[model samples]
Structures are given as structure tokens and as C-alpha cells.
Target chain A: MKTDEKTRAPVARIPDADVPGTVERMRKGERRAIASVITELERLSAAAPALLRSLQPHLGHALVVGFTGPPGAGKSTLVNAIIAQLRQQGRTVGVIAVDPSSPVSGGAILGDRIRMTAALDDDGVFVRSLASRGYLGGLSPAAVRIIDALDGAGYDVVLLETVGTGQNEIDVAEVADIRVVIAAPGLGDDIQAMKSGLLEIADVIVVNKADRPGAEQTLQQLVGALSIRATMSDKVPVLKTSAINGEGVPKLIETLDQLGGKVRAEDAVSRRRRRARYLIARAASDIVANRIKAGSKGGLDTLADSVLSGTMSPHAAATRLLED
Target chain B: MKTDEKTRAPVARIPDADVPGTVERMRKGERRAIASVITELERLSAAAPALLRSLQPHLGHALVVGFTGPPGAGKSTLVNAIIAQLRQQGRTVGVIAVDPSSPVSGGAILGDRIRMTAALDDDGVFVRSLASRGYLGGLSPAAVRIIDALDGAGYDVVLLETVGTGQNEIDVAEVADIRVVIAAPGLGDDIQAMKSGLLEIADVIVVNKADRPGAEQTLQQLVGALSIRATMSDKVPVLKTSAINGEGVPKLIETLDQLGGKVRAEDAVSRRRRRARYLIARAASDIVANRIKAGSKGGLDTLADSVLSGTMSPHAAATRLLED
Candidate 1:
């Protein structure tokens, strides 16, 4: 049961009995079994294959919304407000809060865990905190798989929280149905308008901490930026919310409702399919890379020497290794 | 020259010019075309494929070192110090600083560029700041390609300065021969030392800004943590340095020298191959996923409606989408 002892130890695979039956039952709408299996998977990469198999069915059903912004932008608070409102409408929610863990200790600071104190006790709400674990896009490949697992587990909504401000956090755009980019006042006007590659991915932008001094200014600045980029069809909606005082929480909920409909109805399914295929491509690349790396450990040094001596170029040498 | 302007633009293959006809000449032990082609590519990525192809005979040779840590951890300063030490010993160094651009602005803060001031004016020192655009790893997929470009260009030592701290940043361990994870004192001893996936990948641990009050204590804490996970082959060396004052820089450089050799001689080839393979897989996945998504825009909504209407289970829907 406790499989993670040594690095070289062969990782355990999900039992065949559990795997096939779980997949079948999950397809037939078994929730508790799927959720239990998913929890066990949190400890290790084991159970991932079975989980992935089970997740195959829910690929496009649940709406995935990603929330990201600078720290102290009231993201967690806003998420809580959104969760509460969604639950009121009888929606089952799956929440993943990605907290930064100790690089050396692997223990989570659990910042969001502590903050989402309200969601912990709600049975309708399943809040799981995942360590960023140095994942670039603020999430991991495994995280993408897990999102699928949650979607399969019958949750009506899945919310992914990412480390804010850092640029690598944009990987969220690849996986989510709706992206809520949060920002606050005093962060500069240049920060308001999202640009070509980064902020352009946001479906909805929320200026949190609306009670702050420059909230209106931030809002006005954002509107100005959007005017230049907003095509008649691609207009990004900006909303103001005080997650602390609960201002605009209802409006935020209403906005989410609209976005959800937009994503699932006209042209949204095609968009998500493209994202999913990309995820698959990314996974394939990771697998091949891991294999080639595992095979070439012995020859790297001599290659380096030959390279440093000007006897070979790094590109040529790299190509050789790939060929080998 | 400028590709991917339209979201659906085809992925263009780099011409053989990306790599100079270095392999052909290198087989004859000649250098005629290699230098000229690589020199042209130093200005940008468009010229990479041609240079890469031409240098195919000489790659997988350079000792690629990756430097990463939290912001303000003195990574740039340490990088400068490392380069100076290497150059004094007559090593030609190529430095790549991975700076994720503001998605909205398509621009980088260029902070790391300022720190490598010492190398800026040196012809032997090739310093580049890369935006972690599109790729999750701190370095771009194009980054490895660029490193190949540099390797063919004749730089002996390639150093990667990853500007990300999350999991995507952890992708550096896949590409570098030696990974130097830098940390500052007083951030949180347990937090820094306990990072789950990030700290485990370090070949060398650096505690920069060691002049602070708790610097010594921080070093002690780090050493203690490393001891628990330490292996006979991997006793990650921890160094204390003040990049600003240059104290302990020499020791750090010496450690890098020792470790770089170890990685290059024994495992260098496989490591680079693995990195290349991984990039290929990711690229492939990106292409596939993008196309699938473009084709399946409203599939999720239709599925969601089916599930909500009790026509199908969530699991069933997901499986169908993935399979399709």
C-alpha cells in the first residue's frame, strides 16, 4: 500500500481488477469509487493510468475555470465566493489550489489551504491543494490529467488556482475552459491591458480589491486597452469585485454563467478539442524525452569533452545522440 | 521569417542553414562554413534551423549548466561571477537567461540582462535573454535549438539561467548537465529546503547573499536537509556566496567546474538526447492538440448538456471525447 520508499524501486501500477472495473463503473456513473481512487493517486504517480482511463469519459462535460493573478489579489477569496454561489445553484464543485511547497522539504506552505477554511467543511465542495512542485505553467502535466479525473468524477465545475504574477503561470490557458485573470489597483496601468501572448488568453478579467483607492482607474485603464484589441466577437469582459466584502460576487457568478454557456455552445467544443490534442502532444514529447535521457547517461561526458575541444558542435552532437 | 502570426499557421521546418555545414566540414576537420552561419543566427531564432542543420556534426558537446532560483536570489550576479572565473581559465561561455515575457506586452523585464554586465562586452561570452513563451520550461523549445546554434557557433560552455521557480522551471533538469539551484537566506528555511520536486533535482545548492544576519544559520539548515536525501554519488554541494561582494564566488565556480566535468563525461550525451526527444514530443503534442481543439469547439457543451439531462454519465462523455 505504501509504495514510495526508494528512487530505483519500480513504481506500482494500479491493479488490473481496480483499473478495468473502475473505468467501467465510472462510465456507468459511479462517483465515490472514482473519487477514492483519485485521492490515492495524490501521493504518487501510481494510479495515473487508471485515472486517465476513467477520465476519458468526462473530457468535455464539466467547465474548467482557471483563476490566476498576483498574490494578495484576493483570488482565493473570490474563488470561495464563486464556490458558495455555485453551490447555491446545486452545482457540485471540484477545487484545486496550487500552493508553493518547500523545494527542499516537499511540504506545502498550505497558504491557500488555510485561506480556504470555509470550503474545507463543505461536503459539496472538494478542495485539494497541490504543490506547484516547480511546474512551469504554474501546474504540471499530472495536474492536467488530474483535471480530467475531476471532470470524470462528476463534479459540475472544476477551479484551478495558480501561483500569481510569475510568467510561467500562463500554461493555465492550455487546459481551462474559462480563464479568470485577477489583478488589483496600484499595479500600474501598463499591467491593465493583457498583451499578445500572455494576458490575451483571459476570457474574463476581474479587478479584485475593488475597495482599494485606484480601483476605478484600473477599471478605466483596462477598458481602454480592451478597446484596441476587442474584436466584435472576442471582447473580454472586465468586472470589479471585493472578495473581502463580497461586492460583485453575484455579478461574478452571473458572468461565469454566461461564459460557461458561451464556451459549451457555439464553437467552444472545437476550441477545447484543440487544447486537448495539444495536451496529448505535450505528453508524448515528455515520454520520448524521458526515454532518450534514460538511455544516454554513459556517453554524455566524452561528448562534452569532444565539444569543448572544438572537435564537435553541440548541435551536431545533440543530433547524434537523438539518432543513437 | 515571422511565422505563427495566424493561430493556425503551419509549423515551418528550419532550413539546413540553421546549422552550418559543420558536420560535413568537421568530418574533414575543417571550419570554413560553420562559423559564418552560426554568427548570422546569433541575432535571432529565424536563422536557427539552417545553422542547426549545418552544425549537426558537432553538437551534444558543450557542458550545459542550468542556474535557477527565486527572484533576487543573486542568480544573475552569480552567473556573472561564474562566467568571469571560467573565462579567466580560458573557457568560452555561452549564457542563456530565460525571462518569461509579459504575455500582454510580449516584452521581458530584462532584469537578468543587467547582471551579466561583465560578459556583455566580451566577444567570447555570448549572453542571451530568452522569453519562456509557449513552452512551460524556463527555457524555450527553441532554447535547446539556440544552444545548439551556440555550440555550433564555437562557445565551449553553455549556461542556462532559468527565470522560473515553478514546475515548468523544473524542466531545466532535463536539459542541463549541472543544475545550480540558488536560494536566499531568511525566506523560510523549512520551505526552501523542503521543496518536493525542485530541490531533489539540484546538483549544486547555492545560498547567495550569505552576508545577511541569518546566512550562516540558513546554510546549516540546508546542509542538514541535504544530508537526509544525500546519496553517495549525489552529495549535493552547498556553497555560500555574496555575488555582490564576490565572496565565495571562486568556490562556487570550482564546484561547477568539477560537476560540469562529471556530467559531461559520464551522462552528458543521454541527458541532451533526452531533452531533445522531450522537446520533439511536446512539439508534436502541441500540433496535434491544437488541431483537435480547433475541430471540437462545442463538444463539451453538448456533452455537458447530455450529462445534465441524464442522457449520459460524465465519465462516459469524457472517455468518448478523448478517444475521438
Candidate 2:
């Protein structure tokens, strides 16, 4: 297990602002402090930049493993099983469960939390459920910051479970070091998996609920589909696991361990580079969105009026915005 | 039906570029000319801006209706029925079906095309299947341009059917004058629809495949959900349809026509303004993405290296890039 040297540092007291103290508490693995930072970042407050900057040196220690699939594909159950196995091995884990928050029924996140209560009592495990706030496709904008906070707090592994429904949820690919795509049998899950385009981004394919009928067929279908892309440099492994009974959980963990080490050794720099690029793009987009929302002079409303009145084409209007 | 007077004007022959000629041909309702323009726009060619500029005066005729739901919810079947109903009323229709492109399988789009073959032989109807090109949510960047072309060519209605799996697919809400969310029985589709947050954006809720076993229950569930949200100013209608046998499709079409007319009468300016804003935002994001990809001086790589090496924070790096 990789440990941060800063984990042993003493909690410091800071005057005027509680951010530094919070950072210190977070570095010492205080769950409350970590939760506070995540909430602040989600709110996108002015203090967030300072809090994140203070936590920077302590980041990049945790291995982020993303588990994604269709909603009913047993991803939470699989995640719960994996957490149990990781806890058994004496590894600290932080989980970020990204759930789609609906305007009507907003209780699905609560259901997810209830389903993953296996590790709630264990100090080595910390789980946080995040509502996507309708951002869609794996993680919310606040997810990157939350992951950084968890990583800085010295978790050996950070598990990100996202409900993959459409192609946009592939945002997990940018955040996770290892991407696992899960599927179940008899739900037309094989087709659903293909439609979501999760197969392309998966580093590991897991056929969960493997004890169910048609499990073998689904696994074979995935293997066949993946084989067509075998010309690619990396050959992603497809494994089967009955997460409910803990069957194949050990092997899954072993595979993850091996893949994790190999990735860190071979492509860590490129992975970090990719993540940095994603972060930069996201930040730039957020800035543009804010500018448009704030209705700065020559911003969206002005351009929109021009387009609406037929004074300018939308493409031309867009080009003007880009130039601005 | 709304018609642009600009469509009756003589074809202006420009000396340098034949784009005006193509636009002239498209405005005369030539299917080949429309297809060519759509292709050029999808390619994002140098001539696309000129082509779109020429078509602008002839635009804003078609009522763009967005139909979205989870995959296998029979969205295509519903769309086909809707198209047939529109054609029976002597209205020309254009359909854009957005399918998630899988790098491995790449067959979903083909399946969609096959499913909607009912209107393929009809000159009054045109259908195009667009690969999302991994661009999640809304229509592809090219889709906006295509819709404009179709509108300019004098299609009475342009139907956009998107597979809504995740929340981000709500991009359709921005583009469509009327947003219809479809759900089918016995797939936990009620829950799935709720999770995708489509209820918030929907102008019409469709329970497709209404002849299925649990159809009444699903319909009731949707009604219950919508009733809870009845406090909102816009009371979205929940309707049942068996698209397979054309049951209730006419009522759905009538509802769409009423809603479309109502929205256009009430908020047409704001709707166009919103679309312009979306176009501008998309254009700006594309520019930033291209800049990052091109590796401009002091761009992503330099900042990424700093972030990777722990010299700068991801948030700070992102902020710097935004300022640049």
C-alpha cells in the first residue's frame, strides 16, 4: 500500500479562516474535514481554490478505480463486495458514488447508500454519495475536486461508482486510473452495454451476477465484441463475478491489483496528463458558462438577440463568442 | 404550417463559392441538396459557415420536436408512427436520430435505421441517423446545422429522437420546441425515466408500448409522478401510446402540435435566444477543446506537467488555462 508521509503531520491552527485547519484535519484523515471540503468545492465558493491549493501536495497517492454500468447491473453490490475484500486486506478506501438526481424522485441516492452499508462501520472505509445535479455521464463537475480531497486524505484506493446510461457518462474514463464496466445477464444488458458505448472505455469488463442464467452467453458476447478491437495495444480482460455471494470477488481484486501496479508503472504520467487535460477543459467550460450566465457585456444574451432577429447566423454568433 | 417567403426567391448564383447555389437548391426542397449540406456541415468544412449563412433567411419554419427515452423503450417505433401520422396530414417531415456510437459494435445506428424504415420510401419524409461521435448530450455539434438546413428546406416538422440514458442528454431540451419523453412498461422504465431526470424537461410524457402487461401501472406511476410536480406552471400531459399498432399516436401528434404552437406563440423569441446561447457555448467549448488538442504554446501540456509534478494544483492550473 502507498502511504503519504504527510499523513502523520500534526493538525495546525490557523487564524481568521478555518480552511487551513480544515486542510490539516483532512490530511490527518479526518472524515468530517474531507466531507466539508467536498461540500465547499461543490458549492464552488471563493474559499475552494485556497482549500484545494493547500491540499495539493498531499494529492495523487490514491489509485482511482471506476466502476460503471447500467443502473440495474449490480454495480453497487459489486462495489460493496470489493470494499469488503479491500477492507479485509487492511487497505483504506474512499468511495464516491455518483447518482443521477431526479426532479421528482430524489431518493435513489439514499437507496444506494443503504445498499452499500456493509463498510459503513469500518473506519478504513469512507463513502460519499454525490448527486450529479443533472451534469450526467459518470461524475459531476465537483467530482474531480472531491476525488482530490479523498486522495489527499491518504486513502490507498478511491472507488468511483457511476451509473452508465448514455455515452456522456464516459467522464469516469478521465478520472479513473482503472475503468471497470459491469453488466448483468437477462436484462438485455449486453445490448445496453453496447448502446452506452462503455465497451470502448473499459479497462476491465465484469459480468456481475455470474451465477444467473445466460451469464456465460453475455460474457462470451463481450469477449467476442472486444476481440474485434484486439488490434488495439491493450487487451482488456473480461471477468465474471457473482457479487451477491462473493464469488469471483477475490480474483477480481487480484486482477485489479495487478492491473493497478502495471498501469502505475507504465502509464502513470500519461494518465495524470489526461486527467489534467480534462480538468483544464472542464474549468474552461465552467468559466464560459458562468460568463454567459452572468450576462457580461457582449455575452450570450447579446449574441442570442442578434441570432434571434436574423441579424446573424448562429454559427457566426458562436464564432463571435469564441473570439471574445 | 409555417413557410419562409425566402424559399420562393430565385437561386442566386455567386461567382466564387457554389455554397449559395447549394443553399438555393436546398431551399427548393431538393433532397439531394439537403443531404449534401448536412454532410458538409457534419464534416465541419470551411464552406459550412457560408452555407449556413445563405440558409438563415429561409430558416425558422419547422417545429423541432425532441423524443427521448432509454434505449429499447421503442423510441424509434414511436417516432416512425409519429412520422406516418404527420405525412398523412400532408406535412413534410425530417427526422434526426442520434445514436450512441460504440467503437466496437457500431451497429446501433444501423438498427435504428432499420426500425424507422416505414417512412423511407415516402418523399414527404426524410430520416437521418447521426452518430453522436462520442459527444454526449443534446445533438451532435453538426445536428444544429442540419436542423437549420431542414428548416430552411421547408420541412413542416423536424423530429429529433435521442436515446436518453443519463441526465446530460437533456441537451435536447434546449434544441426542441416540444420535448416528449417516452417510457415503456415492464422494464423498470418508470424508475429509469425518473432517474434520467427527463420529467423536468418534458413537455409531453409518453408511455409507449401501452399494450404491454404492466402498461396501466406504468402509466399510473408516471401520472402520480407528474401530479406531484403539478405545482409547476407548465402542466405536462402524461399520455399512453401503443406505437406498434398506431394506437394513440394521433392524439400524441395532436398534443405535440398544440404544445408546439403554444410554445412558439408564447416564447418563440426566448426559445430562439436560448438556442443561440447553446450554439455559442458549444462553439466556444469546441474551440477550447481544439486549442488543447493542438497543444498551443503555454497550453494544456505545460500546465499538466506542472500539476503532475505537484508544482501546481489541478484547480489552479484549470484557473490559469481559463484566464488564458
Candidate 3:
């Protein structure tokens, strides 16, 4: 137990690992080895290629399912049920719940702690909650890499529970094979699920807390909204589940199972390919930003000050920095 | 009128001001001459040294205020009021709204439309909606440049309205001078505001829809949450407002006025400098990533395919790319 705790702690280290050394360790077929490797990677203050090389093989195997919606929508409850059903089928599972981070201290309580409390002791269930390190989408550049870790660790199905669907949760749209948006009644916006871009991204919509009033109304509204915006290319399914009583969970799993079968049969890999390219581009961009910020000897700062003061224009400042 | 429409159309004839020759024209300070020049700058997929140079004088004169919270918090309404008040005070305003892009088309509908709806028809109110070009925060690299355009255009206040307080919305926290999170009654999860990092980033909290039930409770909770989590740096103020009725709006504006005064007094220039550094570094990274992606033929795609096929590891693939 002590050794396991020690091993697990290093997975969250930061500012370490350029893409290279990590790749080298991963190439050695050392699964648990990457744990300590991420520790060293954290020390580097940037992603190394060697590490990325090591991570590539592990990422492609698992079916990554992203679960997101507004808070109190019982997202974890639904996820818990889905995991249990998959476990019954003898499938290994990996769970990544993106927890909120305290901006001041950079500490997070990992909300899934209470939700997945029962699964803690199960060796078949490996759940990790990533704290949002002030990155957009509740995901830092580290998330894709962490997903790689879970995939390499041999989890057959990876369940990614996002922070929510309000604004930034859309980051999951970049990485998931399937995205399930959970919602309930009285979310204030009668058009809660429909308004904004939320209407467009959901592959599967689950109206949890079905026992409550307005569940049917919520479903009808979503169906109505989907009819208006949805392309015939895909017919989104809306399901209702009472996460508290575990009602309708089996059907939700069945819906997911059917979708999974279809995605694998069709050109889902191509879609994933496009998304992967975007992710790589984003990661590379993050690295460049960090490098530029670190390398500038107060040059960027001074220019920023000048621009803000109206003494220099933003474009002039940007041009100078880029050209330099 | 028809000719003007033809010119303003984003897809129509490229704005001559943004053309290659625009830079040469700009060095001469030909005011209306540069309008076409600025528009032409948007078409080029390369670095625009001329546009950057032209914007050198006005990058940071504006006080950037980000208005965010849950949907229906009357953010637009509040902004409209502020615009009116600022114009009364004889200050020009620039608005950037980060709206979610269409999932299918990735286009934004509210870009020019929302500003018009707000009755901000004055020559001084420059309003633009920035849709995501597949970026995480629904903001493009062009956004900062647009801010520059507005700044150089002589706007004293730049107001940025993000999609809302989800993960992506939080990214705005890093880019603005003042972040005002708008909340209202019946949100239910006070803890969510904290969990989402809204409470931490807010320099001011406006509980819009003050007439709604639970408004007082929500405000109280927000106050309590801030007091507990805040460092010794500053205390965030929570104000009540009805953007519809115009109640508390004057107070809100006064608060903004006071905050701006304080920022100007205490190292205002230095603060802009820090933000400028952050922006440049971020942009520099985007450039590097774009080059690497474009430079590598289908190299990245092939490796991603292998990883997906379970043939090679992610780390291995990333390693190969790094070596290249």
C-alpha cells in the first residue's frame, strides 16, 4: 500500500518531461515505469519528445468516452453505473474525472472522490481526477498525456468525466470517441441544453433525475431542439436515468454500447484522426508559448506595458515580439 | 449603402487596407487609407509585420473588462448599459464577444448581430464577436489583433464577453484587467462558482437579476466563498443589479470606475506588461505548432493511425515526431 501510494503521487508532478526521455522509457515496455518518468518529466517544466514517443502506443487502444453536463446532473452517478456494467462484462476500465483547481494554491478536491467512493478498492477500476491547472477546458496540456497513461496502463475502456458543459467543458469535444451530455430539470434555462453550442456537440443526451418533475418536458425540448439543428448524418439519442435509484441505467449502457459498435464500424477513426491533429497542434502551441514567455528577458513584459499604456499599439508589439 | 455592405462582407473583396501595400500606406499615417489596410491584413495567413507595426501605439491604453457568469445573467444587457454610460462620459468602447462556433460549420451567428441588438449604433461603439476557428476558448489568434485594431482606432474601453463560466470561459480570466462574474438567483450550486474558479478570478461579482428570489442568498454565499478562499491580496465585491430594470447599474459602473482608478494608480503599466508577455508567448507557440504541423506532410497522421490501430505507442509516435 505504501509503495503504491508513493508510485501514484508522481503521476501529478509538473514542469517536468520533455517529449524525448518519456518516449524512451515508454519504448522499454515499462508500464508502471512511466509513473516515475512523469516525475522526472515534471522537473523539466516542458513536454519532452521522448516521453511523447513512449505515450503514442498506449493512447490508441481504449474507447475514450467523455461525460459532461452541468453540475448536479448526476454525471458521476451515471458514470458509476456504466463502469459497473462494463465491469460485469469483464472489461478493464480507466476513469479520468477532471476536478476543479484552486487558482491560488493550485490544489483540487477532486469532486469524484465522493461519487466514486465505492470503487476505490477495486483493482479493476483505476480512476484519476485531474485538477484544472488554470488551463482552458478544465484540461491542461497534460490531459492528453494522462489519457495516454491510462491507455498504456491497459484499461480497455477509458471513461472521461468532464467538469461540466457550461462553457469550457467543450474541450472534451477534442478528444472523446463518444460525448454524453447529462442534464436535469430546472436548470433555469428552459433552453439550457439547446441554447449555445451545447445543442450541437452532444452525441448522447442523458436527462438524469428522471423521477423528478419536468423530465419529460426536458426530453421533449431536447428532442425538439435536436430536430431543428441536427444533421441527418447522425441521429442523437436522448435517454433518461434516475442515477439515485439506478433506474434506466441498463438502457443508457445499451445505448452507449450500440453507439460504440457503430463508431468502430464506420469512419470514426478518421474523425478521431482530425481531432488528434488538432490536439497535437494545441500541445505544440502550448509548448511554444511557455518557451517564448520564459526566454524573453523582460522584453515581452516591457512591450506589453507600452502597448497597454497607448504608447505602443498591440499589433506593433506582437509584430516586434514575433519578429524578434 | 450597397457598396458599403459589399465592402463590409467578410467574404467579399478583401479589404484593401489589409493588403500587402497597407503597411507602406500605414507608415505615412494615412487614417482612412489604413481601413482597407487593416482589412487586408486579415486575409494573409502569414505574419503581418506592417499591421503589427501600425498597432504599436495603441495596444494597451484600453481597460479590458471581462463580463462572465451563467447564461441569462444579463451580461449583454449590463454591457449595453455600460456602453451608454461610457459614451455619456465621452469614452469610445470596443467589444469582443467570444461566442461558441457552430459544431457543423464552425461559424458564429452572433458576431455582428448581438452588438446591433444592444442598440450600440453610435460611431464609437466597435462591437465584434470572435468565434472559434477550432480553438479551445472559442477565441482565435486574431482576437488580440482585433483588440489592437480597436485600440488604435481610439477606443478607451475594451470589453470582452466570453461564452460563460465553464472551463473555456475561465481562460478569459488570464487575459483581462478586471474579471466580473455575473450570477443570479436559482443557480443552486454556489459551490460550483467556487469549483469552476469563478470566485477566485472575479475582481467584481454582479448578481444580475436582482429581483429574482434567492438573489440575496446567492450574493451572501458568493461573499462568504470569496472571504474564505481569497488571499491577502484583495477582496472581491458583490453587487446586485437588474440589467432589465437598470437597477444598480449606475453603482456597477461606479465600481468599475473606482477599480480602474486604482489599477491606474498602482503599477498599471507593469500589469499590462505582464499580460503582454503572456499574449506574445502564447502566440509564438501557436506559430511554432502550426509550422511543425504544416511542415510534416502526413507524418503525424500516419503515426496517429498506427497508435489507433494498436500497432505503435503514443510515446513512440511523439518521440518519432520530436526526432524529425
Q: lDDT per prediction?
A: 0.60, 0.69, 0.61
Q: Which digits, one per residue and each the tens of the lDDT, describe model 1 over residues A1-324? A: 455364322244556467767766755546556555555445434455445545565566778898866444666678888887889989878777665443434443455344445455566666666665453323444455556566777778899876533332555656678888787786432232222233456788888889999998877766655665648225688889998888998898788879899878845345544444444434433444445445455675555444433334444555555455
Best-performing candidate as measured by lDDT? 2
Q: Give the DockQ (2 decimals) of all models.
A: 0.10, 0.28, 0.18
Give lDDT tens digits, candidate 2, residues B37-94.
7776665544555666777677677899988765556887788888888888999999
DockQ of candidate model 2: 0.28
Backbone clash total for model 3 is 63
Per-candidate TM-score, chain A? 0.72, 0.76, 0.68
For residues A66-162, write the lDDT of model 2, one tens digit per residue. Answer: 8876655778788989988888899989988766644455646445464557355666878776766543333455677677778878889999876
* Candidate closer to the true structure by DockQ (higher is better), 2 or 3: 2
Interface RMSD (Å), each candidate? 8.8, 6.2, 7.7
lDDT of each residue in A235-318, candidate 3, tens digit only: 888889988787888898778878888766655346556555655555555555566667756776777655443344444665
Distance from true location, Cα of B53 in model 1, Å? 9.1
lDDT tens digits by residue: candidate 3, B152-236: 6666888988653343465566667788888777744323433346665678899888988988887776665566664722567
- Which candidate wins on DockQ? 2
Better of 1 and 3 by lDDT: 3
**TM agreement with the true structure for every prediction:** 0.62, 0.73, 0.62
Q: Is candidate 1 or candidate 2 better by DockQ?
A: 2
